[model samples]
Target: MKYIVTALICFIILVLISSCRNDFGFTSSTGSLKFSQDTIYLDTVFSTIGSSTRTFKVYNRSNDDIVIPRVALAQGTNSKYRISVDGVPGQVFENVELLAKDSMFVFVETTVDIMDFTGDTEFLYEDTIEFDSGANLQKVALVTLIKDAVFLFPERDAEGIEETILLGTEEDGVRISGFFLDDNELIFTNEKPYVIYGFAGVPPNKTLAINPGARIHFHSQSGIIVARDGTLKVNGALSTTEELENEVIFEGDRLEPLYDDVAGQWAAIWLTAGSINHEINYATIKNASVGIIMDSFNNASNGATLKINNSKVFNSSNTALLGTTASIEATNSIFHNSGQSAVVARLGGDYNFNNCTISNYWNGSFRQDPTLLISNAIPNTEFTADLTAANFTNCIIYGDRNLELALLDDGTSTFNFKFENSLLRFNDSSNSFDGIPAYDFSNINLYNQCILNVDPLFEEVAAFKLRIDNTGGANGIGDPASVTATDISGTTRSTSTVSGEGPDAGSFESSDLSGS
Candidate 1:
């Protein structure tokens, strides 16, 4: 009897150990808690004068169905804090379970007392709500903080009026919402900087120029359209390391792709003719329609001179830089992983680059014009550039053809196209011009000085990105010679040396050109 009792005790201990081992950070299909965002950033905090609201996303990264028990304010006050459980009332616990890979959100409302609270928090505030088992609880904090200076517009009231905010009320340090005015003119002086959505809508008769370090957000369909006399000048800055590589969620995309990820849902700063000059410097425009577009429908042919320097356009749709009849001078910039062509020009447009790097792998079709098998597609149907009129010199152009570039049957030609002392390459079968041969280029010019094999050595093309390594001048070209950003595109660019004789062949120079 004693031996049997001892055996029974041993068996029980073994069972208990097994159960404990199963409950690791890993959850079973039968447990609770779900989360999509591994982390969330309030970015900053608001003051006591008013408040701000940001979404705290929840996702069920697990395959099980979990429930939320109770949602409460954990050490946070009512004025500065409030969270809704899936937009529900009364803290109902039954409905918060997130399905596998499904999405739900928690709304965090913050009110800042402008006259009262004045402080900042470098770290995000954190708390927890009671969650039932099986609920894959993944939560990120949503915070709103006060700033040193905020753009407050004119408040509406019956009695008095000192000033009106240029960007209206709803956009007070929050999201972007506005009308798509195509025929209106907008002017922003020193004191009155127009609060804008994205840089996609350069409406008719409107010209917009942003001051240095002027903050703008492209949250929704915020972009620009340059109507007659409409122009846009954006002067942005080099995002800090913590802020430079960002992650965002698109409508039809996954949770948040990396900074270089391209969903190709690009919007553009579309420029029409007779617009004012656009000068953009030291900025970052990511995940827009198109990085910058010069519409080709204008008859005046004077699309506008776009000066770009020390900029970066990442993960956009086809054609990072699209121009028509516009003189573009871009230097010390970078363009990579475009869904289509990195740069596209039409209607006698000019593309001049120096010490820039550009790369793409979108068959160069979407890079320019990707459509059905229409006989009159832009590149294949009719392509012409007035070389004496069009200028693409002292730069690098690369695509997925390896070092050998692929040419569309109806693509632009090198007519009076002066490529002096530049390197050009493609990734075709021959690795030369013959490997990718299906075009009519009777009008062209070339000055391939020290250009290695006349091909663009793209280390990673399938990924729609490029790394120009001007090591041996064999595969990729780095900026070695001094390149000027203001030369071709007339952009006020930063000075930096490129690696290859082909030099940095795209829109960006990776040499820390800011010298900071």
Candidate 2:
């Protein structure tokens, strides 16, 4: 009796297992597959470089388990495009199964060679992903803009050792990877965009010149270094219109929209000690660890290290303009949106800013430092030097912080600084530095007719359009003698008939305030 009962139980278990076989009977799909998008447009990509992945959904809306007999690219593996069905990647797939009333994700990416393209500079590359075969075939178009760029990267040796230039030896002797630019590649033109993969060093005594409308894109950790005695010139001309037609642009190699305003995508442009005659005009430098770094061996001389005019430097993870014992002359420039200080003069320096705007609206995190920090001494160090002259004339030094300007001195060097007819944001709600000698607003030599603790009423802070309006406190109260004839945008500076005041204080001259 026990043996008979066990046999019946085994029979019941076998029946249950046979009923659970659900993988075998998939019907061949008809031409009823639906897609999230009929076409997927991938953003611009450099030649021979892979693009960011884009996705679309493939839905099997029918009430039956379907099997796609063939899912492949229309070009049959000769195509530049690649696709991944569901989670599997391939140029061609077979027997792709989808459950009834379910969906599958298809991710597409591409890398196209310039030689294969018909256009010289840029071309639209297109392909199609075909689902199934012949009569039941459905297609989704893929498109991407391929741009030809002058790619600059370090070469490797026969043994796979990459060539590297010496940036500087660390205290323990570590070094960063970099390489010197070839002599023929010193001149960057507007014919095509430049994509740099490593630190492109300018050799001593060599000049690196960039023409107007030139675009420079640096990979992660990549930058430009001007060695001793080397000169760096960016001759970008001012555009007649507000679109900045001939402006030079410096940013990261990632052309995707997601990284448009992201900071710290690349390293800073370093003007090393003894580098001279570096001039930048009508240029835009953004998305760097630091916008530019001017360094001097010591406070041995107060000669000009950089002359920047009608330029914009912003969206830096660190300080935008970092100077160490270096002299800089900046006019009609805008520097803002930095993780730390927008402008930093450390270990003493000679800096003259005229009709410039230095503001920080760092929304990434809680920023600890001010927008501008000028010191006669190095922090937590014994290094101290003379601050020859740190002057801001007819400028705007402001930010989201309570105090946007900081002055530090060790009492061992000359701390000479001045702000004439400028606007400064020093609300100091906490009264943190009320008794500090640096915040002595009554000192006419340090603060002459400067507007303090007032909002500038920027047109759009998020977009970095810092042009003030009629309601702006910095509208027309500038020192005419110190102001530039024309602002950064090529707007004429004039006395305001409404306020009966001089030109606007910042880099931009408000047309509405000037009644122009």
**Error in Å for residue 10 of model 1:** 32
Per-residue alpha-carbon lDDT of model 2 for 129-197, expressed as tens digits? Answer: 999877898999999999999999988999998778765565555445678888999999999999998
Please list the C-alpha lDDT of all candidates, in the order they appear.
Answer: 0.47, 0.89
Task: Report residue 337 deviation for candidate 1 (angstroms).
Answer: 1.5
Per-residue C-alpha lDDT of model 1 across residues 388-470, encoded as one tens digit per residue: 33333445554444432332333434333344334455323542454332321322443443253354444455553344333
Q: What residue pairs are clashing in model 2?
A: none
Candidate 2, poorest ten consecutive residues by summed lDDT: 296-305
Q: Candidate 2 local accuracy as lDDT? A: 0.89
Off by over 4 Å in 1: 1-71, 74-206, 236-266, 297-304, 361-390, 403-414, 430-444, 450-482, 485-516
Best by lDDT: 2
Candidate 2, superposed: residue stretches over 4 Å from native: 1-25, 168-174, 241-243, 297-303, 496-500, 511-516
